[model samples]
Target: MIGRIRGMFILGLCSASALAAGTGYQPPFHPDQLKGPPAGRPNEVLVLGSPHLSGMPDTFAPAQLEPLLERLAAWKPEAIAVEAVSGLQCDYMRRNPARYADSVSSYCVDTGPAQAATGLDVPAANAEAERLLAQWPATPSAAQRRRLAAVWLAAGERNSAVVQWLRLPAEQRIAADGMTDALVAFLDKRLQRRDESVLVAATLAARLGLERVWAVDDHTADSPTPKEVEKAAADAITKAWDNPYSKARAAADIPLYANVAQPDGLLAIYRAYNAPESAMQTYRSDFGAALVEPSPQAFGRNYVGYWETRNLRMVANIRDVVGQTPGMRLLAIVGASHKPYYEAYLNLMHDVQLVDAEDVLR
Candidate 1:
């Protein structure tokens, strides 16, 4: 579904925006907002955390992703690192061939192959990556194809032999049909859980020609009942939307479906829907209960805490990594809630450039 041609078109529009901004009209932010990375740093890192777009049709759309991708490309980062595991990066590269090689790094906060290295322990990223790779055809280059084979091989002599065999020409390597079919089956199972975040991340990585994309998340051993948690969270979110206050706010704001005009309008909606303190306590209560029931709130103390920690960690991780890579600019396409947090975090970093979501959204 993700094609190179479509990615190029998106990149072109982003180029135009970068050129237009040359005339420089600076905006002001509160002191609190002005906290995080230092000012004027050449290396730009964008951390975006989006909500599940499929479920929140009124809040987000897939088309909006194009601009975000273009903007990040315009920044011309040395590499575009994503919140995806290395396995997914390999699969995406194999399926979607590009002209140039770009470097991408993923921080795994889960228990996976890279757990000992990053100590992040995020396996979902790896699982998702494997699924994506299986869905796509192997790349044309024999060397590249061999590299992929190496990843799948276990740590032993037999694995090394398989890697050597794959290095041979098309005729030499074992029939790829069997491996290809098995990969497809693996992808089918992975796609069953429709998490839009991985899709958005993968789509952006493929479009940007990023060499590698990193997956960041902590792995959990226990299989928490995600379905029950999701149901509870959904119920809470729906209730808040239907509440009297929420309805009043929605009514006060004209053109319910129109793009939010002022940042305040967007913020007001976010607060009503997800603020830490509000009349509709059921949303928070259910969210907390769901967290506790599943995994003792390891992800967050409450829903708000979860959102805050994830957003802050992303900002922190970007700052930590982008500084090391000279020209790498990151654009994170995250949820609306993360926008406010990023706006505040980036302002604190002295050298880092802050692009307002409102400016881009408009």
Candidate 2:
């Protein structure tokens, strides 16, 4: 039976032209191919898979990240994208709280203080940020950076605000321009957060002389489960995760997280996470198990569907920026689980070339 199924799949590939003749359902083109002979510059994307620093083992020192940061700095990415939802999306979600209340509460920065300070709401502040950046000077004044930082904060993008703030010299990072004392305090607080978005992406961007980091994470796929099915869905999925593959997954990763404070331990952690087999392991453990879940409500399939939908939208957001400026070296930092999906989806872009994460880490 397996041999027969494999033969049928092979025949489907050979039957691509059959679809044009209206005789088969096979797809005619694979987007992963069709790379051009020449372009101004290929859009090279290097995705770094990372553990959430906020959840790292207690032994993990924030200073231990310096070596990893230095290595990535050497890659010279022109643009950096972090796993964060944009302010615009958050603003929209906030207005429709019935569907997004949980997401807003969990992932979004409360921009109220910054909005009051700037007298601009989310959309206005985000637009003003774009306008200022459009013609940002070769050498901006300290006040200019401070003002941009304020605008970014009002837009619900604290990481980008941190980028702007960090670019300024310590003495100049003061309450001027639109930066009120409270807003300044907000950004100062962000610098101390151990989350990957701040500790890694924002810090790296500032060191690389970039003015702003991009927030491309999506929570639009997130919605409260219907009350009727919520508990059953949760129980079913939890049971599915209590499997052998999942146990092995934890076994392999627990040690990696524990030793990150040691010399070269981070590089080891990265290489293991970015290994070619890591994606398959994720499938065998998480999504794949969820997919085959036998619940009558099809809870596992729903879980898998959500995962794919989230990754699809996340990749689409990344593509939006990659399309705007072709031929630039871009870096995307995301959770380890998202790396494979990001790469698979990005490879479908006609112009994007995926740089091996292992190579970058090496």
> Over the full model, what C-alpha lDDT does candidate 2 score relative to the true structure?
0.83
**Runs of candidate 2 exceeding 4 Å displacement:** 1-24
> Local error of candidate 1 at 161, Å?
23
Give lDDT tens digits, candidate 2, residues 4-113.
01111111222222215446576889878887643688889999998878887778777888878988999999899999999999999898888778779878989988
The models' CA-based lDDT, in order, is 0.39, 0.83
**Could you report the Cα RMSD, in angstroms, for every candidate shown?**
16.4, 7.3
**Candidate 1 per-residue lDDT over residues 1-362, each given as its tens digit:** 01101112211222212334365776675554544454344655444434444454355444544554564455554444343323333333333334212211122111233332223222343443355456645443554443333333211111212323323454534324223433323333333333433344544444554423443321111112244355444444344335454455446435423543333343333334333233234333333343333322222223434444554665665666566654456665444434556556755775566554333333
Clashing pairs in 2: none
lDDT of 2 at 185: 83
Alpha-carbon shift of residue 205 in model 1 (angstroms)? 2.3
